[model samples]
Target: MPVRHRWSAAAFCAFALLALAACGTLNTVSGIFGNQINFTAPQLQRYLNNSFPREFDKLGGLVSATLTNPKLTIPPGDNRLRLDFDVGVRAVGAGEVSRGRFALASSLRYDPATRGLHLQNPEIVSMEVPGSGSLIKGGTRELLNAVLAEYAREEPVYRIDSDLLARLPSGKRIGSTDIENGLVVVHLDR
Candidate 1:
């Protein structure tokens, strides 16, 4: 005897959409069906390197610092991305300088309008100054933190390609970004 199977209308519609979206062959099947996009460490590192060597001297030019050589890492189950960078501080007239290390972790989020993955709610895991316990004690640390906040909020760590996802289609957009398998995974939502 042979058995007959039935397919629901909703299921058929979903499958049809997936097939149509993936017909171009430009994007992977995972991207089309699973609605996921992955960005490797090297890709994110390159973006940081290009934006780095950033200087923040907006405080009446009294104190200034330059951040460079950003190292990015995903600590497996942390569900957050870690950023480590070198900081060189210089006083306006005194010319006195202090060097330090800044390590921060931030959660990720996606913005539909911009199609970019941005850092949200950044936390300072460690701030180290050689020969000193933690530079975070001084006001300079506060300034550094402010700069980091701006970087995280104002700048996007990575942007989803226009071609990969295609132009925005009304309610469809990237959503619920996370760090997994040493890569930033972006999911789509409608």
Candidate 2:
């Protein structure tokens, strides 16, 4: 065999082996990483605590409200997410402003069409209006519920960004979402 031909064959074999090794490395890395991503409860809680107040303030209406000092928790063995915060509300026409604290519990659901997570069926479990008489407090609670109901129908408490899911491996999509032991587990299609 000619020396030149032998050199060309050796180079070709080397290139082929390198290409195969690269493919193997890629497969190994993907396998190690798995097909799922998890957002722990504390991490989400921090994100909400920082951003939710600004988002809440965007809802301007008859009873405009701002949520402050927000705290989020997921109860053990429960699939729901709970948020507690101090809320300041102002009536549009009445010129009445009040401060209070409230807690909301919501179930988590993944919307396949949107490729996002949503807080569904939010319920105001508790509310307190400081310095208000019983009658006034009752009226305030009713009014808050009405306002919340309207908002609930229109928006979710929080939504995971679609762009986040877009970065996943091709053909990978959110398969399921569950809250377990204060963590939000998002399973992805392999």
* TM-score of each model, paired residue for residue: 0.73, 0.63
Off by over 4 Å in 1: 1-33, 112-114, 131-137, 167-171
Kindly report which residue pairs in candidate 1 clash with one another: none
Residue 69's lDDT within candidate 2 is 85
Cα displacement (Å) at residue 71, model 2: 0.9
Clashes of 2: 0
lDDT of 1 at 131: 53
Worst 10 residues of 1 by lDDT: 24-33
Q: What is each predicted model's overall lDDT from 0 to 1? A: 0.74, 0.67
Least accurate 10 contiguous residues by lDDT in model 2: 24-33
Best lDDT among the predictions, by candidate number:
1
> Which candidate number has the best TM-score?
1
Per-residue alpha-carbon lDDT of candidate 1 for residues 1-190, written as tens digits (9 for 90 to 100): 2233244666788999998877854322224435666776667787788888888784788888888889988887788899998888777786646788888899788876666778888888888766533543476578778887777667777766778777445566677887877767777687
lDDT string, candidate 2, 16-132, tens digits: 999999986652231213666666566566556656663233235655666678787887888888878787766767665678998888776676654445666778899988987
